[model samples]
Target: MELLFVFLGGAIFGTIARYTLPHRDEHGSVLVPAIGAVVASVVWVALTWLGWAWDGGWIWWVSLGASVIAVVVADLAIGRHRVQTDAALLTKLTGSTATATAH
Candidate 1:
């Protein structure tokens, strides 16, 4: 089905994003791709409900684009948050400023 293809496309894009982006070490390998597939699937279903034809070109574009956006944004946000949290934890445990040491 078209949905399956879209889901696979989203997952592929997500896999690409996961490897391409920095701070990938912060999360599991599956996380980014999973996010991508979910975003694409949700967008596709929503658009179909809102009257976009399933076979239309624009629908595919919008759905896939949304998946990429969601995947990238989530990856970046999670990476940054993890880094900050880790730094804070390090500072708390060692009683020294991790940020200061990095600079």
Candidate 2:
């Protein structure tokens, strides 16, 4: 179905967004692409429900565009959150004795 194509396109860009980002290794590969595909699918469905035909160009564009944007933002947020978590964990494990100036 045409929705498949939209999802596929979003996946491609999502994969690109993930692989192209720094520290991508910190996260799972499937997560980013999965997010992209799902977002695209939902967007496409929403547009269709709102009267955009299946073959409409705007539907395709908006769906794919939002998916890519969401993927990138989500990827970045995950990476940053992981980094912060690691830092917090390290601090906790090291105990309060190790302050910022301890380095």
Candidate 3:
């Protein structure tokens, strides 16, 4: 019963993470769910290590909520970094091409 609850919590967290990070690309959709699963596992482990007991039903809910939030936050931070890196790459590429063409 406890294992079932934990699995359900992880699934809900995964779904929430997917919904929070809306992606038009199918590739992103698949990746986000897997990322969410990892986030859920991390949260579960952390909570367990921190002496959090799962005797209460609310523990599952709390863990799931925290996991979802963590996933969303991580996705946003990483996405911003990726965008900046991509922009830099494009700028460098354009500059190199222009310089080459000038020669």
Candidate 4:
């Protein structure tokens, strides 16, 4: 019951976090949602150890907000790698030809 709720909460948090972020061509997929789920699971475990119970009230709201922040921060930090990888791919695809013409 509680475990199920935690997972559901995580899914919701991940979805919202993914929606809130800018549409990066690299991250415009299910990765953010998956990351969110992992983040939620970690938070749930920590909270459980701290004796926090989710009764679906203010505590839940706080936990949700925290989880969202965690997801956003993690995405921002880890997403740089994805962006760099995408940039490298783009550069490779475009080749070394430098176009002087303005778009």
**lDDT for each of the candidates?**
0.94, 0.89, 0.63, 0.68
Using TM-score, rank the candidates from best to worst.
Answer: 1, 2, 4, 3
> Which residue pairs come into collision in candidate 3?
none
Candidate 1, overall lDDT? Answer: 0.94
| Candidates 2 and 4, the one with greater lDDT | 2
Q: Look at candidate 1 and tell me the lDDT of residue 8.
A: 96
Off-target runs (Cα >4 Å) in candidate 3 are 1-8, 19-27, 49-51, 96-103
Clashes of each: 0, 0, 0, 0
Which ranges in model 1 have alpha carbons more than 4 Å from their true place? 98-103
TM-score to true structure, per model: 0.92, 0.90, 0.63, 0.65
lDDT of 3 by residue, 37-89 (tens): 66666666677778878686556667677667766776676677777777678
C-alpha lDDT of residue 81 in model 2: 95
Error of 4 at 79 (Å): 4.7
Model 2 ranges with Cα > 4 A deviation: 96-103
Candidate 4 lDDT, tens digit per residue, 1-103? 7656766787777787777776434465667667666666677767777877666465566556667887788667667877777778876877633632222
Clashing pairs in 1: none
Candidate 4, superposed: residue stretches over 4 Å from native = 54-59, 77-80, 92-103
Among all windows of 10 consecutive residues in model 4, the one with the lowest summed lDDT is 94-103
Prediction 4 TM-score vs. true: 0.65
Query: Between the candidate structures 1 and 4, which one is better when assessed by TM-score?
Result: 1
Give the per-residue lDDT digits (tens) of candidate 2, residues 1-103: 9989988988998899988987698799899999999999999999999999887688888999999999999999999999989888887887754574586
RMSD of each predicted structure: 3.0, 2.4, 4.1, 3.7
